[model samples]
Target: MKVQRHKCMNERCSYDQQERIPFATGSCSYTHRLARYVIDLLKAMGLKDVSGLMDVSWDTIKDIHVRYLERHYSPPSLEGVDCIGIDEFAVKKGHVYKTIVVDLRTGRILYVGNGKGADSLDGFWKMVRKKGVKIKYVATGCMERTGCK
Candidate 1:
């Protein structure tokens, strides 16, 4: 269907012929409903794994997820967090180590990192400084570095 557009009075305007459509879509190619549906299934289906089921390219599914996150998600604020807990846990009996930082007040996982050491919490430290979060108490467990640094 052709859209009848009107031209601007100014000859210098680049977009002189502009058409307004009530059914125009946003920058995202997918419709709002389809995008939401993809996001809903994304958690369980996954982008790479869902490409076959959705019959779309892996990159397309990945882009859809990126757009979904950009529109709906924001990093949680660490402001007002006074207490935190950091611990290193072994996966498969010492083959892998992961460090996790949690908010003591709300019990939310703030940061996760591979390899346990002082540097494991570096990501959290940087975010804390940027967010101006003051830590009054910290409970750490099993800080032994297993040479995974």
Candidate 2:
């Protein structure tokens, strides 16, 4: 068994690093402290525009997203899951669209795609097929105007 230790930064916080050295005079853990530090740096740098700047590339957002996702997105092994719920929503009206699929039983978000068209759903199906998942049913819905089928 493996254990991960996190040091708290807040002086009054109840939790402490049980296995390693405590953080230097802080109440939150090392991870929380690091996040606060990064946010403060970004704010001090006058980075008001988080979406698309010369210095901040898509890769930067993608990296942060992927890292955070690896911590949260857990897809169950395709063994008995047969029912899936699919839906599409736009980032903004008439702008970028994204599709989402959820496992009906586990209530886990399974897939995400960049478009609301049938092509996006097809791409998800292709990936699942390639992975040899036994898909018994797929229920999908779209916006009233998209007419996705």
Candidate 3:
């Protein structure tokens, strides 16, 4: 749709602005309804399939999905958190790995860090110290590697 551009008549304060569309965001090519539909389709389809079905680019569909996730799923609260589980797994075939910290009771992911070792958990430990989180029981996947009994 073509939005009509409005120009201010005042000589001193001349400004041009395009009319805002109620169903769409600023400068975005897709409407809110279309974005919602794409998100719904994503639940039952993959990214490439959704892109092919909607005739939109893969990157655009991924961006829309990411934006929706960011808007709805913020970081989980750390309050009243006691027991947590730490585990690291390779993101791909190579040495690249990621460490994840999850609340044992609620099964909610608390932190994700790059790499897989003691250093990867430094940030989480710092946060726990700052927040005074009294972690009583600790569980890890690599007991032998960490020398934990």
Candidate 4:
């Protein structure tokens, strides 16, 4: 498929139409229907498997999911959050660790940080305060692992 390129008419402006053509799904080769189909398939299949089945690049599948998530969750709202649980999980056996903060009431992840320490929880604390989510209890990980008293 050949897309006609458009050049800027004004002397000051130098914008050209080299970007991807905006399809019915916004700006992708696959249509909105196909994007949804791919997302549906993703629920049961891995990205690589989906890519193989769809005969598209793995990155394209990932891009489709990412765009969909961004569109749906444009701005995160912390409206009725009261209690949140924070814990550290190992990404790889015991070498790598990360912190995850989940809302106890709604079971939604509020924050995830790289290191498993007080610094990791800093962002969650600041965000909850800014959002005015009046948190009551914060259940953290065990003292045996994180040493929290």
Candidate 5:
């Protein structure tokens, strides 16, 4: 049986090959980076056994995922908005918390920030201001504990 290779995952870049190519920095082609993300996500979701899961190396998976995150999630600049809604939630099981801000009119969560504080809310406001988005009214839940308003 012949093995199948995947294409590169660098967003609209596709160059697949049966043999690996080394770049000037001694790195494999972009296709390998894409393969690594799939491998890493699978491993993270408890598919690391590799026999039934297709014999992928852990190091490869980790490298790809890290690269993917660095490329994809590097926070973008927010601009031109109106009416933001703020809400907080406990994302993880134990102690982790996060705040999600959304545009009320458009109903899109503009950004997620750390902590459930006025500072976090302030950060979100700053982002909007930086983007030249006007803030009309903020729809938010009660700040019972920290005296946030």
Candidate 6:
């Protein structure tokens, strides 16, 4: 897509601007339709495969996926949450750990944190306190080890 560049012919004030493409976002090379197609392909394929098929870089495919996620899934609200389940799972060969907090009633994930144990939930606890969520029941994978109630 070629965008026409407009230049001011005035010698005293020389200003130049390019016409914006209707199908693409500001400064992005890919069109909106292409991005949507890539996202659809990603649902069935991995990042590397999608990038190869689309003839785009792996990082570009990742960036498109991340932007799509950010636009669609903004974090769920913690309001009216009484029962919550907390669990820690290994991400890679039991080395990298990730903590996930979920609302028992709706089964919606509230927070995700890096690492495990009590320290992983510090930010979640702060958010719960700040939001004034009165959590009544708590279910955890390791209650004794994590000191969770």
From the highest TM-score down, the ranking of the candidates is 1, 6, 3, 4, 5, 2
Worst 10 residues of 3 by lDDT: 140-149
Question: Per-residue lDDT tens digits of candidate 6, residues 1-149?
Answer: 56899899998877987788888877776889989999999999999999998789998888889989998998778888999998989988999999889999999999998898888888999998889989899998778655586
Error of 1 at 68 (Å): 3.3
Among all windows of ten consecutive residues in candidate 2, which has the lowest summed lDDT? 21-30
Candidate 2 per-residue lDDT over residues 21-42, each given as its tens digit: 3542233223445444444455
Tens digits of per-residue lDDT for model 5, 48-132:
5532455656665555566667876776545556576778888677387788878777777778878777665667667665677
Could you tell me which 10 consecutive residues in candidate 6 have the lowest summed lDDT?
140-149
Q: Which stretches of candidate 1 lie over 4 Å from their true place?
A: 1-25, 40-57, 69-74, 143-149
lDDT of 3 by residue, 1-149 (tens): 67899998999887988789999888778899999999999999999999999899999899889989998897766898988888888877957989889999999999998887777877887888888888787799865543234
lDDT of 1 by residue, 37-105 (tens): 788888887687788887888887888888778776666678778998888889999999899888999
Please report how far candidate 4 places residue 12 from its true position, in Å: 18
Clashing pairs in 1: none
Model 1 worst lDDT window (10 residues): 140-149
- Model 3's number of clashes is 0
The lDDT values for all models are 0.75, 0.61, 0.85, 0.79, 0.63, 0.88
| TM-score for each model | 0.69, 0.45, 0.55, 0.55, 0.49, 0.58
RMSD, every candidate, angstroms: 4.8, 11.9, 5.2, 5.5, 9.6, 4.7
Compute the lDDT of residue 104 as modeled in candidate 5.
78
lDDT of model 6, residue 112: 95
Predicted candidate 5, C-alpha RMSD: 9.6
Error of 4 at 65 (Å): 3.7
- CA shift at 67, candidate 2, in angstroms? 7.1
**Candidate 4 C-alpha lDDT tens digits along 1-149:** 77677799999998876445555453467777788899999999999999999899999999988998899876556788777788888887889879887888889887887887877667767787788788777788554443334
- Which number leads on lDDT? 6
Cand. 6 TM to true fold: 0.58
